[model samples]
Target chain A: MSQQKILSRPSVGAFMSKYGIVVIFVGLCIILSIMSPVFLSMRNITNVIRQVSIIGIVSMGVTFAIITTGIDLSSGSMIALISVVVATLSQNAMNPDQPVSIVMPIAIAVAISLLLGIILGAVNGTLTAFGKIPPFIATLGMMTVARGAAALYTRGRPVGDLKETFTFIGTGSIFGIPLPIWIYLAMGILAHILLSKTKFGRHVFAIGGNEQAARICGINVEKTLVKVYAFAGFLTAVSAILLTARTSAGNPTYGLSYELDAIASTVIGGTSLSGGVGSIPFCVIGALIIGVLNNGMDLMGVNAYWQQIAKGVIIVAAVLIDARKQKRG
Target chain B: MKKTVLVLVAMCMLILPTAIFANGQQEDGKILIGAAMSSFSDKGQTYLQDGVREFDAENDDVEVLMTDAKDDAAVQLNQIETLLVKGVDAIFIVPVDISALKPVFKKCKEDGVKVVIGNRMPAEELWGEFDVYTGSESIQAGILQAEWVAEAMQPEGGKVGIIMGPLGHEAARMRTEGNKQIFAKYDNIEIVMDAEGKWDRAKGMQIAENWIQSGANLDAVLCNNDEMAIGALLAAEGANLADDAIIIAGVDATPDALEYLGAGLDVTVFQNMNAQGYNGAIAAYKLAKGESVEKWDWIPFETVTPENMSEYK
Candidate 1:
């Protein structure tokens, strides 16, 4: 009876693992508030979230991909490809004298970019599922191919002088909240619904838990994997459009190493790299932690080199502390 | 073991860029000049390639064959070897790494191929390897830009902030050195803060926002590149800072930068990519024809502001 009681008792690792991301975020906020006067201001807080929203949205998509025991290294490259392609379609024709002129309606451009992202993502999914390539290798190949394609499309030039109306989607604020943050919130809510309430979401967890068992239980594992990757591609395209609009130009060099940032956020949020257990809320918190750290470091005039070191240290420390209890359990 | 070796070789072949052979064919009657550029993906380098292409189009006897290094030194060396094997008369090279071009220079010397380097400024020790160098001195860009900033800050001088590119980049280091050196000349002009923007519009905007909110007496902002300048401009505007409240200057006078001249941005330095490309190509052509050319043919950096922006256009 005593042994049964001990088995039922929860380990500290289990408790910490579940709540560590939130704890880290709260802890960071408290520390930053103490360090910088403007760290907790409303405008600055909005600034932090606005800056993070692009990468934050990408991290949410990565969370879903991870929950299925898959990865998306192509997010960064896809952003570049989609940014340049969409910019080309929406950009005002080459005009001298007043560069920021009127442009073509961007509705079609947005649709085309989204379609391109979905198709490319589906390609990643198909290669992994049908061709039996590992997710890492398949997405890695896509990453290279997409980046090369973006560079080739523009011949290494920036597609600047974009239409003003389209840029509003990136820069505009509604009710004092920026549109990127709004889009991030909307996507997070939608992702939560898709992951918790839908049958596809349940299948994702099942596949990550045990692929053979999921297959034996009649889950269409191949089709689901494709959908998972395709979804990640779609989210990446959303970020690409927002980023291009915000910058007021699209260059092939954009989104360099962004996938790593997205993955880092996902991992820090306590999404198991080994798969099957994660949540959307924790992913948001994960992205927020990084954003706060960066903003705080900048505000305090931390040396840029030391900031890089600090970032590396904090990410590792957060993951290590969170994982220690789990390892023991 | 043989099967494994064969498979590995095939995989390697599959991954190699098709760019080497894309424009490598030599015509029977043409003076083929190979142009091995550091990166075609770079916006500035693309313009340099265009300058070479313009030079090629103007002369019927000359054909400029260009190969992109894709920012890889080894790949650039491989491309040069292939060019050498095909027997080009002269080569216009924008080295991916100036130091690592020793092999290319040595090989070109052996083949009696005239070599003309562009864009990047090699050290004094390596100047004899190439016949001509057609690009502005990197240090001059920063000096010219900061000279304008020093003047704009006026007699009182006020506090200044700097936004630089990636920390270890050659251009960023040289440009920052020039900016700091010039600012040190004035007693009143004190540098309050500086940050690395990583040459991105978004990151620059973020850093600028942080600096603005820091309550420093910022009178001027100098950025290594125009993208970051524009970012700082946007951040300042977002903070409700007036147009003339702070002076902003950038190195590259990009088209987007030109739009804001005199309106918000004080001044910017134009690096003259067109001159670099055209002059470098012409020098290579002249060298191929056994004509002597200047060892250091300079294309000076020009300041662009509202008054002179039209001249640049």
Candidate 2:
């Protein structure tokens, strides 16, 4: 197949396979703009990006997990847990007569959340890689545990009255751009480089593609799997911090079933769930498509039920198109 | 295979009754009432449980056997059936979905067990099927929310946005309807956007942020519940909107909402959950004892504004 491709110009099918998803995303934007004038405005465009930023960050992590032939159902629950912890810490610092600098509490909150995310991710990784449990089951168990911990921590009450400095992390802008968008872009770039340029990245793809062959080739498959999941956990902590910031509070019920949205974003971005075939850029676009569909429908005043139906249809269509491309390839 | 079957049957014999009998402690002289909760995760459900516990503490002749349905209609139906098997004198249910529980309610009725529907009312067709329906009038909360919005917008009514909870939900529907009725009275107030927030704070914030960015020229946001109102507040504060730049009103008056109000949220409506639950349980007990009780009991909603914030706190 490679010899034939080197000898001839790329076929129409191949070209479409490479660029079809991008075309669909652009086409959706154009169509939405035509249907609703507000859709194309710069302000609205930024809003859409801002809206997609949370899911986009989390999806980048899930993208890694998908490429490694693993799933992380615990991201949503991890976010819930981390948000509660951070909210509690930040709220405590904001109390009157505290002598410490505001930075102390915020830093401590972020550090604790990151550490907890890593530990949780490591637990999933250990179960899946060493315990020989299926990725789905391992993460599903963690999902429940993490959620319970969050609810138990606050007893179902939402934490509020956060410090101004803590809220600023979510609401503050960097050079007229929202902080979340910058964080998402930075994360996306980092993930792209790690997946495409690093040896550990190649190890992940190899392990996902054929674990037996990867082990035979002297790759530390278990270690790579654990590291991949750890990366996903770290990303989820980042997302939780941003989300908690945006809402200006943390509630146990926050981020319910959000892992499903992240998975959907990854799948819709043309990531093959079977493994070893997805990109961060495409995942961002996929997240954007979802964000656009939601924002556009709201602007057009479509019924929420119809909006859900449309979202489901588009997700299926995206997968169907990807399957068609696979057949051609 | 015969030995395995014998062992399995023995295990079931030992396990089945113990599980069912956990809450089935019925005394000869006491009336046993079964309570099925739709969920215990949210504040409202917890508040309901607190009221029930309060009732149990005060009552001597009545025992309440409660079960959590975990927000699943099927689980709720199963719990009701379990309660029925235990042969409770009466059953009270806060259904996950009013429509989904009709058959179960019918089954209870056929068994001659009195049913009290709490929190949410079933459709009008099933109104006659249940002994009583008790809770706050959901529409009243909406009316209070919209009235506050109207008052805040004043004579120079401005464009408003409505952040609805899950569409088609009875509470959400009634609340939106109430808002519509009030807005209709004032020609000056225009609803520019009415988007579903899916009863989520993040979703509510996302919609509000988008509306703000779209330059929708919105002056107020009416949320069906406290969660969404808090979301809108975050969005407005993020956009650097002045404290009084926009009027925001929400229902439920949750603890978080009250905190938001204390921190400068415009308005909230208190639905009096304690009264609803305590009163509902007492009425159920009265009916169970063959005493006269109101068939349809309504708990009023109180408006909480910044001016009267001290009273609520």
User: How closely does chain A match the true chain A in each prediction, as TM-score?
Assistant: 0.93, 0.94
Model 1 segments more than 4 A misplaced? A1-14, A92-103, B1-27
Candidate 2: segments with Cα more than 4 A from true spot:
A1-13, A34-42, A93-104, A300-303, A319-329, B1-31, B60-63, B110-112, B262-264, B288-290
DockQ (model 1, Cα): 0.55
Query: TM-scores of the models, in the given order?
Result: 0.91, 0.90
Which candidate number has the best lDDT? 1
lDDT of 1 by residue, A144-198 (tens): 9998999888776677777878888788889989898899899899888888889
lDDT, candidate 2, B55-124, per-residue tens = 8779988888898887788889889988887767677788898677777777777766778888886788
- Native-contact fraction for each model? 0.49, 0.49
lDDT (Cα, tens digit) per residue for candidate 1, span B1-313: 9999999989777645333433333445677788999988877787788898899899998888899999899999999988876678889999888888898899888878888989888888998898889888888888999999999888778988888888877788888888999999999998877888987777788888887777675899899998889888878877889999989898788877888788778999999898899999999888888899988889999988888899876
Report the Cα lDDT for candidate 2: 0.83
Residue A248 Cα positional deviation in candidate 2, in Å, after optimal superposition: 0.9
